[model samples]
Structure formats: C-alpha cells, structure tokens
Target: MPHVTFIEHNGTAHTVEAVIGKSLMEAAVDNSVPGIDADCGGACACATCHVFVAPEWEAKTGTRNEAEVAMLNFAAEVKPNSRLSCQIEITAAHDGLVVHMPDGQH
Candidate 1:
C-alpha cells in the first residue's frame, strides 16, 4: 500500500494507506476524506473527484488523459495541477503523495 494525503480546501488533512492498484478516489472515499465526492464512483464521467496534485508530486502522478481533460472543463476552479482523482493509480513511488481539494469540491 502507498500512503496518500488528502487536504481539504479549508486545510484539513487526512492521511491513509491506499491499496495497491486502487484509484486515488477510492482511497479518499474509503477513508472518508472530506472534499472528494466521487459521485461517478471512480468513473471518468464525473469531475466531482477533482484534486490538485501537489507540485512536488506532479511527475509521479502523470498528466490527465484526453477524457479526463475534457471532463475537467465541468469542474470549478480548474488549475494547472487539477486532476480527476479516479484517473490516478497508486504506486510505491507515490508513497508520500499529497493532494489538495478545490474549494468547489468542499
């Protein structure tokens, strides 16, 4: 498992270990981390699982795919680091990954 940190727009942080191969959205939802609504249940159809990948961890998380970038247009406060959490897979290299939830998501 890789440890992930979810920080709410208001600055609350929840850290948990995510099962290998699981989506980042699943880890956040499983741990009851605030701000990740995940209304589409890990599907790329929804932008409710929006997150801001910390700058330091950006390279490890990878860029958004075509579908993900298209869906992000529907999300509020989209930023350069915005990503659909469901599209991110956990790996050992992401052990210290940190993400920030947008104010809209909260």
Candidate 2:
C-alpha cells in the first residue's frame, strides 16, 4: 500500500492508504476525499480529477502523458504542475506523495 496526502485548497490535508497499481483517482474517490470527482471513471477524457502535484513530489510523479496534457488544458486553474489523477497509477515509490486540490474543483 501507498499513502497519498491530498491537500485541499484551504490547506486541510487528508492522508489515505491505497493499494499499489490502482489509479490515484480511484483512491481519492474511494476514501471520500473532497475535490476529486473522477467523473470520467479513470479515463483520460475528463479533467475532473485535476490536481497540483506538490513541488517536492513532482519528479517522483513524473510528467503528464500527451493525452493528459491535452485534457488538462480544459481543467480549472491549470498550472505547470497540474495532472489528471486518473492517469497517476500508485506504486511503492509513490508512497507519501502529496497533491493539492484546486478551489474550483468543488
């Protein structure tokens, strides 16, 4: 299992343990975390799962794929670190990863 820390726009943080190999969007939605809708059901078509990767964890999470990059363009308040959570698969190396939800996601 890997732990993911989701930081809300207001700075509230919720840490949840998730199974490795599952997408980050699944983990957040399963844990009832606010801000991640995962409206497209883990597909790259929707940007509802958009999140900002924490600066320190950016490298670990890696860059977005072409599909994610295109979808992110439609996400609210997109930033350089923006990523679609559905595209982020959890792994042992991703343990303790932190991400921030955008205010508009609600």
Candidate 3:
C-alpha cells in the first residue's frame, strides 16, 4: 500500500494508506479524508474529487486524460496542478504523495 496525504482547504492533513491499483478518490473516500466527495463514483464524470497535486509529485502522478480535463472545468479554484482524484490511480511510486483540496467542490 502507498501512503498518501490529503490536505483540506483549511490546512488539515489526513494521511492514509492507499491500496495499490485503486484510485486516489477511492482511497480518500475509504479513509474518510475530508473534501473528496467523488460524486461520480470514480467515473471521471464529475469534479467533486478535485485536488491539487503537489509540485514534487506531479511527474509521478502523470497528466490528466481528456475526460478528467473536461470534468475539472466544473471545479472551483482550478490551478495548473489540479487533477480529478478519480483519474489518479495509486502506485508504488505514489507513496508519500500529497494533494490539496480547494476551498470547495463545485
């Protein structure tokens, strides 16, 4: 399992062990990390799972696919590092990954 840290908009951090091959959205939801609603159930159809990938982890997390890019347009406070968590599958390289939530999910 990879350990991921999810930081809330208010600066709280929740570190959780994430299963390999699962999506980050699933990990957050399973661990009860705040701010990741995953409204589309990891289908990449919604932006409720939006997160800002830390600069250091960006390369490892990879670029967003077209569907995720499209969905993020509906998110609030979108930034260059923004990603739909459902699109980021957990991998061994993702250990210690950190993501920040926006003030709110749109």
Candidate 4:
C-alpha cells in the first residue's frame, strides 16, 4: 500500500494507506479523510473529487485525461495542478504523494 497524504484548505493533513489499483478518491472515502466528496463515485463525471497535486508529485501523477479536463472545467478554484482525485489511481510510485483540496468545490 502507498501512503498518501490529503491536505485540506484549512491546512489539516490526513495521511492514509492507499491500496494499489484503487482510485485516490476511494482511499480518501474509505479512510474518512475530509475534503474529498467524490460525488460521482469515481466516474469522472463530476468535479466534487477535485484536488491540487503537490508540485513535487505532479510528474509522477501525470496529466489529466480529456474527460477529467472537461469535468474540471466546471470545478471551483481550479489551478494548474488541479486534478480529479477519481482519475488518480494509486500505485507504489505514488507513496508519500500529497494532494490538497481547494477552498471550495462546486
């Protein structure tokens, strides 16, 4: 399992052991981490799973796909590193990955 840390807008951090092959959104929900609503159930159809990939982890996390890019268009407080958590699958290489939630989500 990879250890992923989720940071909230208020500066709180939730570090959880994430399972391989599962989406980051699922890990957050399973671990009861705050800030990731995942309203679309990892379908990539909604922006409730929005997160900002820490700059250092951006390359490892990779770029957003078309669907994610489209969905993020409707998200709030979007940034260059913004990504839909549901689109981010967990892997060993992602250990110690850190993601931050926006101040608000639409």
Candidate 5:
C-alpha cells in the first residue's frame, strides 16, 4: 500500500494508506477524507475530486490525460498543479504522494 497525504484548506493534513492500483479518488472516498467528493465516480465527467498536486510530487504523479484536462476546466480555482483525483492511479512510485485540497471542495 502507498501512503497518501491530503492537505486541507485549513492547513490540516490527513495521511491514509492507499492500496496500489486503485484511483486516488477511490482511496480518499473510502477513507472518508474531507474534500474529495468524486461525484462522477471516477469518470472524467466531474471535477469534484480536484486537488493540487504537491510541487515536488508532480512529476511522480505525471500529467493529466486529455479527458481530465477538459474536466479540470470546470473545476474551481484551477492552478498549474491542479489534478483530478479520479484520474490518478496509485502505484508504487506514488508511495508518499501529497495532494492539497482546494477550499471550495468541501
């Protein structure tokens, strides 16, 4: 399992153990982490799972696919580091990934 860190808008951080091969959105929702709604259920239709990938972890997480990029256009407070959690697949390389949730996601 990989350990994922989710940083909240209030500067709170929650770390959860996520199983590899599952989507980041799935892990967050399963752990009851605040901020990721995943309203589209891992499909690229919704941006409720929007998150900001930590600067240092960006390369490890990789760039967004075309579908995710399009969906992000509808997300609030989009940034250079913005990503949809449903689009991120957990892997060994993402063992310590950290993502920051936007204030509005809650």
Candidate 6:
C-alpha cells in the first residue's frame, strides 16, 4: 500500500494508506478525506475529484488522459498541476505522494 497525503486548501492534511491498483479518488473517498467529492465514482465524468499533484510526484502520476482533460474543465482553480484523482491509479511508486485540494469543487 502507498501512503498518500491530501492537503486541504486551508492546510489541513489527511494521510491515508492507499491500496495499489485503486484510483487516488477511491483512496480519498475511502478514507473520508475532505474536499474530494469523487462525484462520478472514478468514472472520469466529473471534476469533483480534482487535486493538485505535488511537483516532485508529477512524473510518477503520469499525464492525464483525454477524458480526464475534458472533465477537468469543470473544476475550479485549475492549475498547471491540477488533475482528476480518479484518473490516477495507485502504485507502490506513489508512496508518500502528496496532493492539494482546491477551496471548493465545481
């Protein structure tokens, strides 16, 4: 399992043990991390799972897919590191991964 830290817009941090092969959104939802609504249930159909990938972990998280790119258009405060957590599968390499949530979901 990988341990990921989700930092809220206000600086609160929730660190959860994420199961490999599961999506980041699932990890957040499973641990009840605030700010990650995961409204589409990891279907890549909504931006409620939006997160900002830590710069050092960006390469490990990989590039967003076309569907994720499209869905993120609906997210608030999109930035260079913005990503739909549902699109990122967990792996051992992602241990210590840290992500930030926006002030609110769109």
Off by over 4 Å in 6: none
Worst 10 residues of 6 by lDDT: 68-77
The candidate 5 region of ten consecutive residues with least summed lDDT is: 97-106
User: What does candidate 5's lDDT look like per residue over 1-106, in tens digits?
Assistant: 8899999889999999988999999889999998888888888798999999999999888899999888888777999999999888999998889999997852
**Pairs of colliding residues, candidate 3:** none
Q: Which residue pairs show backbone clashes in model 4? A: none
RMSD of candidate 6 to the truth, in angstroms, is 0.7
Better of 5 and 6 by lDDT: 6
RMSD of 2: 1.2
Which scores better on TM-score, 2 or 6?
A: 6
**lDDT at 66, model 2:** 99
Q: What residue pairs clash in candidate 5, if any at all?
A: none
lDDT of 4 by residue, 1-106 (tens): 7999999999999999999999999999999997888887989998998999999999999999999999999887889999999998898999999999998767
List lDDT for all candidates, in order: 0.91, 0.89, 0.93, 0.92, 0.89, 0.92
The top-ranked prediction according to lDDT is 3
Q: Candidate 1 residues 1-106, lDDT tens each?
A: 7899999999989999898899999999998987889998987998999999999999999999999999998887999999999999998899989999999752
Clashing pairs in 1: none
lDDT of 3 by residue, 1-106 (tens): 7899999999999999999999999999999998999888989887999999999999999999998888888776989999999999999999999999999988
Candidate 6 per-residue lDDT, tens place, 63-104, comes to 989998888877768898999998999999999999999999
What lDDT, from 0 to 1, does candidate 4 have? 0.92
lDDT of 2 by residue, 1-106 (tens): 8899999989999999977989989889999998888878988998999899989998888899999988888776998999999898899999999999998652
The Cα error of candidate 5 at residue 18, in Å, is 0.6
Model 3, residue 84: C-alpha shift (Å): 0.4
